[model samples]
Target: MKFIISVDCEGPACVVGNAGKALSASRDYNFACREATLEANAAARALFDSGAREVWIWDSHGQGLNLCIDQLDKRCKLILGKGFTCRFPGLDNSFSGVVMIGYHAMEGTKNAILAHTYSSESYKNIRVNGQTVGEIALDGAVAGEFDVPVIFVSSDDKGCREALTFMPWLETVVTKQGMGRNCALSKHPHMVQEEIYSGVLKAVNCIHQTKPLKFKSPVQLEIDFKAVSQAVKALVYRRRGWRLVGPRTITKKIESMREWIC
Candidate 1:
Protein backbone atom coordinates (compact mmCIF):
# COMPACT_ATOMS: atom_id res chain seq x y z
CA MET A 1 0.00 0.00 0.00
CA LYS A 2 0.96 3.63 -0.51
CA PHE A 3 0.34 6.48 1.95
CA ILE A 4 0.70 10.21 2.35
CA ILE A 5 1.20 11.98 5.64
CA SER A 6 -0.12 15.55 5.53
CA VAL A 7 1.76 17.28 8.34
CA ASP A 8 0.84 20.62 9.89
CA CYS A 9 2.98 22.41 12.49
CA GLU A 10 0.43 23.18 15.14
CA GLY A 11 -1.53 20.77 17.44
CA PRO A 12 1.42 18.41 17.77
CA ALA A 13 2.59 17.88 21.35
CA CYS A 14 5.93 19.55 20.58
CA VAL A 15 4.26 22.71 19.23
CA VAL A 16 2.27 24.97 21.53
CA GLY A 17 1.77 27.86 19.08
CA ASN A 18 0.99 28.20 15.38
CA ALA A 19 3.38 28.25 12.41
CA GLY A 20 2.93 32.03 12.04
CA LYS A 21 5.67 32.38 14.63
CA ALA A 22 8.08 30.63 12.27
CA LEU A 23 7.91 33.71 10.03
CA SER A 24 9.73 35.68 12.77
CA ALA A 25 12.67 33.23 12.84
CA SER A 26 12.21 32.31 16.46
CA ARG A 27 14.31 29.58 18.16
CA ASP A 28 11.22 27.86 19.54
CA TYR A 29 9.87 27.73 16.00
CA ASN A 30 12.87 25.72 14.80
CA PHE A 31 12.64 23.44 17.81
CA ALA A 32 8.96 22.79 17.16
CA CYS A 33 9.66 22.05 13.51
CA ARG A 34 12.37 19.59 14.44
CA GLU A 35 10.11 17.80 16.87
CA ALA A 36 7.30 17.63 14.32
CA THR A 37 9.81 16.23 11.84
CA LEU A 38 10.60 13.39 14.22
CA GLU A 39 6.91 12.68 14.71
CA ALA A 40 6.29 12.65 10.96
CA ASN A 41 9.27 10.40 10.37
CA ALA A 42 7.95 8.09 13.02
CA ALA A 43 4.70 7.76 11.12
CA ALA A 44 6.58 7.18 7.90
CA ARG A 45 8.69 4.46 9.44
CA ALA A 46 5.59 2.80 10.80
CA LEU A 47 3.96 2.82 7.39
CA PHE A 48 7.04 1.27 5.82
CA ASP A 49 7.12 -1.40 8.49
CA SER A 50 3.46 -2.13 7.83
CA GLY A 51 4.25 -3.23 4.25
CA ALA A 52 3.75 0.14 2.57
CA ARG A 53 5.29 0.36 -0.89
CA GLU A 54 5.61 4.16 -0.66
CA VAL A 55 5.16 7.02 1.79
CA TRP A 56 5.05 10.72 0.95
CA ILE A 57 5.29 13.52 3.46
CA TRP A 58 3.76 16.90 2.69
CA ASP A 59 4.92 19.91 4.67
CA SER A 60 1.43 21.34 4.91
CA HIS A 61 2.37 24.19 7.23
CA GLY A 62 2.98 27.87 6.54
CA GLN A 63 4.86 28.52 3.32
CA GLY A 64 5.11 24.69 3.04
CA LEU A 65 8.73 24.77 4.20
CA ASN A 66 8.52 24.21 7.95
CA LEU A 67 9.77 20.62 8.35
CA CYS A 68 13.39 19.73 9.01
CA ILE A 69 13.97 17.96 5.73
CA ASP A 70 17.36 16.57 6.71
CA GLN A 71 15.76 14.65 9.55
CA LEU A 72 12.85 13.09 7.68
CA ASP A 73 12.74 9.37 6.95
CA LYS A 74 15.17 8.73 4.11
CA ARG A 75 12.84 6.33 2.34
CA CYS A 76 10.01 8.84 2.13
CA LYS A 77 9.63 11.50 -0.54
CA LEU A 78 8.95 15.07 0.63
CA ILE A 79 6.61 17.61 -0.93
CA LEU A 80 7.59 21.15 0.00
CA GLY A 81 7.02 24.78 -1.03
CA LYS A 82 3.81 26.53 -2.09
CA GLY A 83 2.10 28.19 -5.13
CA PHE A 84 0.31 25.02 -6.14
CA THR A 85 -2.61 25.47 -8.53
CA CYS A 86 -4.99 23.42 -6.38
CA ARG A 87 -5.58 21.86 -2.97
CA PHE A 88 -3.63 18.71 -1.98
CA PRO A 89 -1.38 19.12 -4.95
CA GLY A 90 0.30 15.89 -6.17
CA LEU A 91 -2.37 13.80 -4.42
CA ASP A 92 -4.25 11.43 -6.74
CA ASN A 93 -6.22 8.19 -6.90
CA SER A 94 -3.00 6.20 -6.85
CA PHE A 95 -2.54 6.64 -3.10
CA SER A 96 -4.19 4.32 -0.61
CA GLY A 97 -4.80 6.57 2.43
CA VAL A 98 -3.88 9.89 4.05
CA VAL A 99 -2.46 10.43 7.52
CA MET A 100 -2.90 13.89 9.04
CA ILE A 101 -0.40 14.80 11.71
CA GLY A 102 -0.34 17.87 13.96
CA TYR A 103 -3.68 19.23 12.70
CA HIS A 104 -5.85 21.84 14.49
CA ALA A 105 -9.48 22.79 14.90
CA MET A 106 -11.50 25.44 13.07
CA GLU A 107 -11.38 29.20 13.71
CA GLY A 108 -14.01 29.35 16.46
CA THR A 109 -13.38 26.03 18.16
CA LYS A 110 -13.41 26.48 21.94
CA ASN A 111 -10.17 25.64 23.76
CA ALA A 112 -8.39 24.66 20.60
CA ILE A 113 -4.70 25.43 20.39
CA LEU A 114 -3.69 27.80 17.62
CA ALA A 115 -7.08 27.32 16.07
CA HIS A 116 -7.88 28.71 12.60
CA THR A 117 -9.22 27.60 9.26
CA TYR A 118 -6.60 27.97 6.46
CA SER A 119 -5.42 31.40 7.71
CA SER A 120 -5.37 32.99 11.11
CA GLU A 121 -5.05 36.54 9.82
CA SER A 122 -7.63 36.37 7.04
CA TYR A 123 -10.38 33.78 7.31
CA LYS A 124 -13.02 33.91 10.02
CA ASN A 125 -14.59 30.59 9.06
CA ILE A 126 -15.07 28.21 6.12
CA ARG A 127 -18.24 26.22 5.60
CA VAL A 128 -19.22 23.43 3.25
CA ASN A 129 -22.95 23.11 2.83
CA GLY A 130 -23.52 25.45 5.81
CA GLN A 131 -21.37 23.32 8.12
CA THR A 132 -18.24 24.94 9.52
CA VAL A 133 -15.10 22.88 8.84
CA GLY A 134 -11.41 23.01 9.55
CA GLU A 135 -8.49 21.62 7.50
CA ILE A 136 -9.35 18.11 8.77
CA ALA A 137 -12.69 18.10 6.96
CA LEU A 138 -11.53 20.07 3.93
CA ASP A 139 -8.46 17.94 3.37
CA GLY A 140 -10.40 14.76 4.01
CA ALA A 141 -12.91 15.77 1.35
CA VAL A 142 -10.12 16.48 -1.09
CA ALA A 143 -8.61 13.05 -0.45
CA GLY A 144 -12.09 11.58 -0.77
CA GLU A 145 -12.26 12.89 -4.32
CA PHE A 146 -9.45 10.44 -5.06
CA ASP A 147 -11.11 7.60 -3.15
CA VAL A 148 -8.48 7.89 -0.43
CA PRO A 149 -9.60 7.75 3.17
CA VAL A 150 -7.89 9.73 5.93
CA ILE A 151 -7.00 6.72 8.03
CA PHE A 152 -5.13 8.31 10.91
CA VAL A 153 -4.75 11.72 12.56
CA SER A 154 -2.83 13.18 15.52
CA SER A 155 -3.62 16.51 17.12
CA ASP A 156 -4.84 18.23 20.25
CA ASP A 157 -7.91 16.85 22.01
CA LYS A 158 -10.37 19.04 20.13
CA GLY A 159 -8.67 18.33 16.84
CA CYS A 160 -8.82 14.58 17.32
CA ARG A 161 -12.52 14.90 18.20
CA GLU A 162 -13.09 16.92 15.05
CA ALA A 163 -11.46 14.24 12.93
CA LEU A 164 -13.60 11.60 14.60
CA THR A 165 -16.77 13.42 13.61
CA PHE A 166 -15.71 13.13 9.98
CA MET A 167 -14.15 9.65 10.08
CA PRO A 168 -15.42 7.72 13.01
CA TRP A 169 -13.38 4.67 12.03
CA LEU A 170 -10.20 6.74 12.03
CA GLU A 171 -7.32 6.03 14.39
CA THR A 172 -6.33 9.16 16.29
CA VAL A 173 -3.72 10.27 18.82
CA VAL A 174 -4.27 13.31 21.05
CA THR A 175 -1.00 15.06 21.64
CA LYS A 176 -2.40 17.72 23.92
CA GLN A 177 -5.45 19.19 25.58
CA GLY A 178 -6.12 22.77 24.55
CA MET A 179 -6.68 25.34 27.29
CA GLY A 180 -6.96 28.22 24.87
CA ARG A 181 -5.88 29.16 21.37
CA ASN A 182 -2.24 29.41 22.41
CA CYS A 183 -2.28 27.28 25.53
CA ALA A 184 -2.19 23.51 25.82
CA LEU A 185 -1.28 20.71 28.24
CA SER A 186 0.90 18.67 25.97
CA LYS A 187 2.43 15.23 26.25
CA HIS A 188 6.13 14.73 25.90
CA PRO A 189 7.48 14.66 22.36
CA HIS A 190 8.71 11.09 22.84
CA MET A 191 5.30 9.97 24.02
CA VAL A 192 3.59 11.73 21.13
CA GLN A 193 5.87 10.02 18.59
CA GLU A 194 5.31 6.65 20.19
CA GLU A 195 1.57 7.08 20.00
CA ILE A 196 1.75 8.28 16.42
CA TYR A 197 3.78 5.23 15.41
CA SER A 198 1.41 2.83 17.10
CA GLY A 199 -1.63 4.65 15.76
CA VAL A 200 -0.44 4.45 12.18
CA LEU A 201 0.21 0.74 12.54
CA LYS A 202 -3.33 0.20 13.80
CA ALA A 203 -4.80 2.35 11.03
CA VAL A 204 -2.97 0.34 8.40
CA ASN A 205 -4.40 -2.86 9.81
CA CYS A 206 -7.96 -1.60 9.38
CA ILE A 207 -7.55 0.24 6.10
CA HIS A 208 -10.07 -2.02 4.44
CA GLN A 209 -12.84 -0.96 6.84
CA THR A 210 -12.34 2.79 6.60
CA LYS A 211 -14.27 4.78 4.05
CA PRO A 212 -13.39 8.02 2.27
CA LEU A 213 -15.09 11.16 3.54
CA LYS A 214 -17.54 12.25 0.86
CA PHE A 215 -20.18 14.97 0.72
CA LYS A 216 -23.33 14.98 -1.34
CA SER A 217 -23.26 16.50 -4.81
CA PRO A 218 -23.77 20.25 -5.39
CA VAL A 219 -21.71 21.54 -2.48
CA GLN A 220 -22.15 25.06 -1.15
CA LEU A 221 -18.80 26.64 -0.29
CA GLU A 222 -18.67 29.76 1.86
CA ILE A 223 -15.82 31.84 3.22
CA ASP A 224 -16.12 34.44 5.99
CA PHE A 225 -13.10 36.67 6.04
CA LYS A 226 -11.91 38.45 9.16
CA ALA A 227 -11.79 41.90 7.55
CA VAL A 228 -13.80 43.71 4.92
CA SER A 229 -10.57 44.52 3.11
CA GLN A 230 -9.87 40.83 2.69
CA ALA A 231 -13.29 40.30 1.22
CA VAL A 232 -12.87 43.31 -1.05
CA LYS A 233 -9.59 41.87 -2.30
CA ALA A 234 -11.23 38.50 -2.90
CA LEU A 235 -14.02 40.05 -4.99
CA VAL A 236 -11.91 39.35 -8.05
CA TYR A 237 -13.02 35.76 -7.63
CA ARG A 238 -16.58 36.87 -8.34
CA ARG A 239 -15.98 36.20 -11.99
CA ARG A 240 -15.03 32.66 -10.97
CA GLY A 241 -18.23 31.77 -9.10
CA TRP A 242 -17.77 33.78 -5.92
CA ARG A 243 -20.61 36.03 -4.73
CA LEU A 244 -20.56 38.71 -2.05
CA VAL A 245 -22.95 37.35 0.55
CA GLY A 246 -21.89 39.91 3.15
CA PRO A 247 -19.27 42.61 3.68
CA ARG A 248 -16.75 39.98 4.78
CA THR A 249 -18.25 36.84 3.31
CA ILE A 250 -18.20 35.10 -0.09
CA THR A 251 -20.27 32.15 -1.24
CA LYS A 252 -20.06 29.79 -4.21
CA LYS A 253 -22.08 26.81 -5.28
CA ILE A 254 -20.33 23.99 -7.11
CA GLU A 255 -21.34 20.66 -8.55
CA SER A 256 -18.68 18.66 -6.69
CA MET A 257 -15.91 18.97 -4.13
CA ARG A 258 -13.48 18.94 -7.03
CA GLU A 259 -14.98 22.16 -8.47
CA TRP A 260 -14.41 24.10 -5.24
CA ILE A 261 -11.20 22.46 -4.06
CA CYS A 262 -9.38 20.53 -6.79
Candidate 2:
Protein backbone atom coordinates (compact mmCIF):
# COMPACT_ATOMS: atom_id res chain seq x y z
CA MET A 1 0.00 0.00 0.00
CA LYS A 2 1.09 3.57 -0.56
CA PHE A 3 0.92 6.07 2.29
CA ILE A 4 1.61 9.78 2.67
CA ILE A 5 3.16 11.35 5.73
CA SER A 6 2.80 14.99 6.68
CA VAL A 7 5.46 15.60 9.29
CA ASP A 8 5.77 18.47 11.74
CA CYS A 9 8.35 19.18 14.45
CA GLU A 10 6.59 20.69 17.43
CA GLY A 11 5.18 17.38 18.61
CA PRO A 12 8.11 15.12 17.92
CA ALA A 13 9.99 13.27 20.66
CA CYS A 14 11.99 15.65 22.87
CA VAL A 15 10.10 18.53 21.30
CA VAL A 16 8.72 20.77 24.02
CA GLY A 17 8.87 24.30 22.58
CA ASN A 18 8.13 25.92 19.27
CA ALA A 19 10.03 24.39 16.41
CA GLY A 20 11.62 27.75 15.68
CA LYS A 21 14.43 27.07 18.09
CA ALA A 22 14.39 23.51 16.90
CA LEU A 23 15.30 24.60 13.39
CA SER A 24 17.69 27.38 14.21
CA ALA A 25 21.35 27.23 13.32
CA SER A 26 22.33 27.90 16.93
CA ARG A 27 23.47 25.22 19.35
CA ASP A 28 20.08 25.02 21.07
CA TYR A 29 18.22 24.34 17.84
CA ASN A 30 20.82 21.76 16.92
CA PHE A 31 19.62 19.22 19.47
CA ALA A 32 15.95 19.88 18.78
CA CYS A 33 16.44 19.42 15.06
CA ARG A 34 18.16 16.12 15.68
CA GLU A 35 15.21 14.95 17.72
CA ALA A 36 12.81 16.00 14.96
CA THR A 37 14.79 14.05 12.38
CA LEU A 38 14.86 10.91 14.50
CA GLU A 39 11.12 10.99 14.98
CA ALA A 40 10.46 11.33 11.27
CA ASN A 41 12.99 8.67 10.42
CA ALA A 42 11.42 6.30 12.91
CA ALA A 43 7.97 6.94 11.54
CA ALA A 44 9.25 6.42 8.02
CA ARG A 45 10.83 3.12 9.01
CA ALA A 46 7.54 1.97 10.47
CA LEU A 47 5.61 2.89 7.36
CA PHE A 48 7.97 0.91 5.16
CA ASP A 49 7.81 -2.21 7.33
CA SER A 50 4.02 -2.12 7.46
CA GLY A 51 3.31 -3.15 3.88
CA ALA A 52 3.66 0.42 2.72
CA ARG A 53 5.69 0.06 -0.43
CA GLU A 54 5.76 3.74 -1.26
CA VAL A 55 5.75 6.47 1.32
CA TRP A 56 5.61 10.13 0.36
CA ILE A 57 6.47 12.58 3.12
CA TRP A 58 5.95 16.31 3.30
CA ASP A 59 8.04 18.34 5.72
CA SER A 60 5.06 20.18 7.10
CA HIS A 61 7.03 22.32 9.52
CA GLY A 62 8.34 25.85 9.69
CA GLN A 63 9.95 26.86 6.40
CA GLY A 64 8.96 23.29 5.38
CA LEU A 65 12.60 22.30 5.59
CA ASN A 66 13.30 21.19 9.14
CA LEU A 67 13.86 17.54 8.24
CA CYS A 68 17.44 16.45 7.80
CA ILE A 69 17.14 15.07 4.28
CA ASP A 70 20.20 12.87 4.64
CA GLN A 71 18.83 11.06 7.67
CA LEU A 72 15.49 10.08 6.13
CA ASP A 73 14.95 6.54 4.89
CA LYS A 74 16.06 6.07 1.32
CA ARG A 75 12.75 4.60 0.28
CA CYS A 76 10.69 7.67 1.03
CA LYS A 77 10.37 10.98 -0.82
CA LEU A 78 9.86 14.43 0.70
CA ILE A 79 7.76 17.46 -0.21
CA LEU A 80 8.87 20.89 0.90
CA GLY A 81 7.92 24.52 0.36
CA LYS A 82 4.94 26.38 -1.04
CA GLY A 83 2.30 25.76 -3.71
CA PHE A 84 1.16 22.58 -1.93
CA THR A 85 -2.41 21.85 -1.43
CA CYS A 86 -4.49 19.26 -3.10
CA ARG A 87 -6.72 22.22 -2.57
CA PHE A 88 -3.69 24.31 -1.60
CA PRO A 89 -0.57 23.13 -3.53
CA GLY A 90 -1.21 19.76 -5.23
CA LEU A 91 -0.94 16.44 -3.44
CA ASP A 92 -3.63 14.35 -5.05
CA ASN A 93 -5.49 11.61 -3.20
CA SER A 94 -3.85 8.53 -4.61
CA PHE A 95 -2.62 6.81 -1.46
CA SER A 96 -4.13 4.18 0.83
CA GLY A 97 -3.59 6.22 3.99
CA VAL A 98 -1.97 9.36 5.39
CA VAL A 99 0.08 9.79 8.54
CA MET A 100 0.59 12.97 10.55
CA ILE A 101 3.74 12.74 12.58
CA GLY A 102 4.82 15.24 15.19
CA TYR A 103 1.78 17.46 15.27
CA HIS A 104 0.53 19.42 18.31
CA ALA A 105 -2.72 20.71 19.75
CA MET A 106 -4.49 23.77 18.41
CA GLU A 107 -3.68 27.33 19.53
CA GLY A 108 -4.63 28.10 23.12
CA THR A 109 -4.11 24.51 24.22
CA LYS A 110 -2.84 24.75 27.77
CA ASN A 111 0.27 22.64 28.36
CA ALA A 112 0.41 21.66 24.72
CA ILE A 113 3.98 22.16 23.69
CA LEU A 114 4.23 24.92 21.14
CA ALA A 115 0.51 24.91 20.54
CA HIS A 116 -0.64 27.39 17.97
CA THR A 117 -3.37 27.28 15.39
CA TYR A 118 -2.26 27.92 11.83
CA SER A 119 0.06 30.92 12.18
CA SER A 120 -0.07 31.22 15.96
CA GLU A 121 0.03 34.92 15.31
CA SER A 122 -3.02 34.93 13.07
CA TYR A 123 -5.47 32.41 14.47
CA LYS A 124 -6.90 31.93 17.94
CA ASN A 125 -8.85 28.89 16.91
CA ILE A 126 -10.09 27.33 13.72
CA ARG A 127 -13.14 25.12 13.47
CA VAL A 128 -15.10 23.11 11.02
CA ASN A 129 -18.79 22.81 11.76
CA GLY A 130 -18.05 24.16 15.21
CA GLN A 131 -15.46 21.53 16.24
CA THR A 132 -11.98 22.68 17.27
CA VAL A 133 -9.21 21.80 14.82
CA GLY A 134 -5.48 21.57 14.51
CA GLU A 135 -3.08 20.92 11.60
CA ILE A 136 -3.65 17.17 11.89
CA ALA A 137 -7.37 17.61 11.39
CA LEU A 138 -7.10 20.15 8.58
CA ASP A 139 -4.62 18.07 6.62
CA GLY A 140 -6.71 14.96 7.24
CA ALA A 141 -9.63 16.74 5.66
CA VAL A 142 -7.48 17.42 2.64
CA ALA A 143 -6.72 13.71 2.39
CA GLY A 144 -10.38 12.91 2.91
CA GLU A 145 -11.40 14.80 -0.21
CA PHE A 146 -9.76 11.95 -2.10
CA ASP A 147 -11.12 9.18 0.11
CA VAL A 148 -7.86 8.55 1.94
CA PRO A 149 -7.95 7.80 5.65
CA VAL A 150 -5.38 9.17 8.10
CA ILE A 151 -4.44 5.94 9.82
CA PHE A 152 -1.66 6.97 12.17
CA VAL A 153 -0.47 10.11 13.94
CA SER A 154 2.04 11.13 16.62
CA SER A 155 1.92 14.19 18.82
CA ASP A 156 1.55 15.41 22.39
CA ASP A 157 -1.16 14.11 24.74
CA LYS A 158 -3.38 17.12 24.18
CA GLY A 159 -2.97 16.69 20.48
CA CYS A 160 -3.85 13.03 20.87
CA ARG A 161 -7.09 13.94 22.60
CA GLU A 162 -8.01 16.62 20.07
CA ALA A 163 -7.41 14.20 17.23
CA LEU A 164 -10.04 11.69 18.36
CA THR A 165 -12.78 14.25 17.84
CA PHE A 166 -12.02 14.01 14.14
CA MET A 167 -11.16 10.34 13.76
CA PRO A 168 -12.29 8.21 16.63
CA TRP A 169 -10.63 5.05 15.35
CA LEU A 170 -7.26 6.39 14.32
CA GLU A 171 -4.15 5.30 16.24
CA THR A 172 -2.11 7.97 17.98
CA VAL A 173 1.25 7.92 19.75
CA VAL A 174 1.84 10.70 22.22
CA THR A 175 5.49 11.60 22.45
CA LYS A 176 5.12 14.24 25.11
CA GLN A 177 2.84 15.70 27.74
CA GLY A 178 3.11 19.44 28.06
CA MET A 179 3.02 21.73 31.05
CA GLY A 180 3.12 24.73 28.71
CA ARG A 181 4.39 25.51 25.26
CA ASN A 182 7.93 25.69 26.54
CA CYS A 183 7.91 22.83 29.01
CA ALA A 184 6.93 19.19 28.67
CA LEU A 185 7.57 15.62 29.70
CA SER A 186 9.25 14.10 26.71
CA LYS A 187 9.57 10.46 25.78
CA HIS A 188 13.01 9.23 24.96
CA PRO A 189 13.64 9.69 21.27
CA HIS A 190 14.50 6.01 20.83
CA MET A 191 11.38 4.86 22.61
CA VAL A 192 9.26 7.19 20.55
CA GLN A 193 10.90 5.77 17.44
CA GLU A 194 10.08 2.24 18.44
CA GLU A 195 6.43 3.11 18.80
CA ILE A 196 6.44 4.99 15.52
CA TYR A 197 7.68 1.87 13.77
CA SER A 198 5.04 -0.24 15.47
CA GLY A 199 2.10 2.12 15.06
CA VAL A 200 2.38 2.11 11.30
CA LEU A 201 2.19 -1.65 11.22
CA LYS A 202 -0.89 -1.70 13.39
CA ALA A 203 -2.50 0.96 11.25
CA VAL A 204 -1.92 -1.05 8.10
CA ASN A 205 -3.50 -4.11 9.60
CA CYS A 206 -6.66 -2.19 10.37
CA ILE A 207 -6.64 0.34 7.53
CA HIS A 208 -9.54 -1.31 5.82
CA GLN A 209 -11.66 -1.19 8.94
CA THR A 210 -11.74 2.59 9.24
CA LYS A 211 -13.58 4.92 6.95
CA PRO A 212 -12.29 8.06 5.30
CA LEU A 213 -13.44 11.26 6.97
CA LYS A 214 -16.67 12.46 5.41
CA PHE A 215 -17.77 16.05 5.60
CA LYS A 216 -21.20 17.09 4.49
CA SER A 217 -21.73 19.06 1.34
CA PRO A 218 -21.68 22.82 1.77
CA VAL A 219 -18.88 22.47 4.27
CA GLN A 220 -18.72 25.26 6.77
CA LEU A 221 -15.56 26.77 8.22
CA GLU A 222 -15.18 29.34 10.95
CA ILE A 223 -11.94 31.18 11.65
CA ASP A 224 -11.22 33.06 14.84
CA PHE A 225 -8.42 35.47 14.23
CA LYS A 226 -5.79 36.23 16.84
CA ALA A 227 -6.13 39.87 16.08
CA VAL A 228 -9.18 41.80 14.97
CA SER A 229 -7.03 44.01 12.77
CA GLN A 230 -5.83 41.03 10.80
CA ALA A 231 -9.39 39.91 10.28
CA VAL A 232 -10.27 43.32 8.96
CA LYS A 233 -7.18 43.87 6.82
CA ALA A 234 -6.64 40.39 5.43
CA LEU A 235 -6.95 40.31 1.67
CA VAL A 236 -9.58 37.63 2.19
CA TYR A 237 -11.53 40.07 4.29
CA ARG A 238 -14.77 40.98 2.54
CA ARG A 239 -13.40 39.09 -0.46
CA ARG A 240 -15.76 36.19 0.05
CA GLY A 241 -18.80 37.73 1.59
CA TRP A 242 -17.99 36.09 4.95
CA ARG A 243 -20.13 37.03 7.88
CA LEU A 244 -18.73 38.59 11.02
CA VAL A 245 -19.87 36.16 13.68
CA GLY A 246 -17.73 37.64 16.43
CA PRO A 247 -15.30 40.53 16.75
CA ARG A 248 -12.43 38.40 15.55
CA THR A 249 -14.32 35.45 14.13
CA ILE A 250 -15.50 35.00 10.59
CA THR A 251 -17.97 32.39 9.42
CA LYS A 252 -18.28 31.42 5.82
CA LYS A 253 -19.42 28.49 3.75
CA ILE A 254 -17.08 26.33 1.64
CA GLU A 255 -17.63 28.14 -1.59
CA SER A 256 -16.94 31.37 0.16
CA MET A 257 -14.13 29.99 2.22
CA ARG A 258 -12.62 28.45 -0.89
CA GLU A 259 -12.42 31.82 -2.53
CA TRP A 260 -10.65 33.10 0.56
CA ILE A 261 -8.32 30.17 1.10
CA CYS A 262 -7.72 29.13 -2.49
Reference-based lDDT, residue 27, model 1: 46
**In model 1, what are the clashing residue pairs, if there are any?**
none
How high is the CA lDDT of each candidate model?
Answer: 0.86, 0.75
The sequence of per-residue lDDT tens digits that candidate 1 reaches over residues 1-262 is: 8999999888778566544553225445777788779889989999999999999999988889889888887899989998786677788999999999988888889998888888878889888998888899999998898999999999999999999998899999999999987677889999999999999999999999999999876889989999998997887755688899999998888876766541
lDDT of 2 by residue, 1-262 (tens): 8777887777887755444543244344556666777777877787787767888878767667677889888898878876543332445566888888888888888888888876766888788877777777777776777788889888999999888888998988989888777788888889988998788778888898777776665668788887888777653645665777777888778732223242
Best by TM-score: 1
> Could you tell me every candidate's TM-score relative to the true structure?
0.95, 0.88
lDDT of 2: 0.75
Q: Can you list the residue pairs that collide in candidate 2?
A: 83-89, 84-89, 85-88, 85-89, 85-90
Q: Tell me the alpha-carbon RMSD of every candidate.
A: 1.9, 2.9
Clashes of each: 0, 5
Candidate 2 residue-wise lDDT at 32: 62
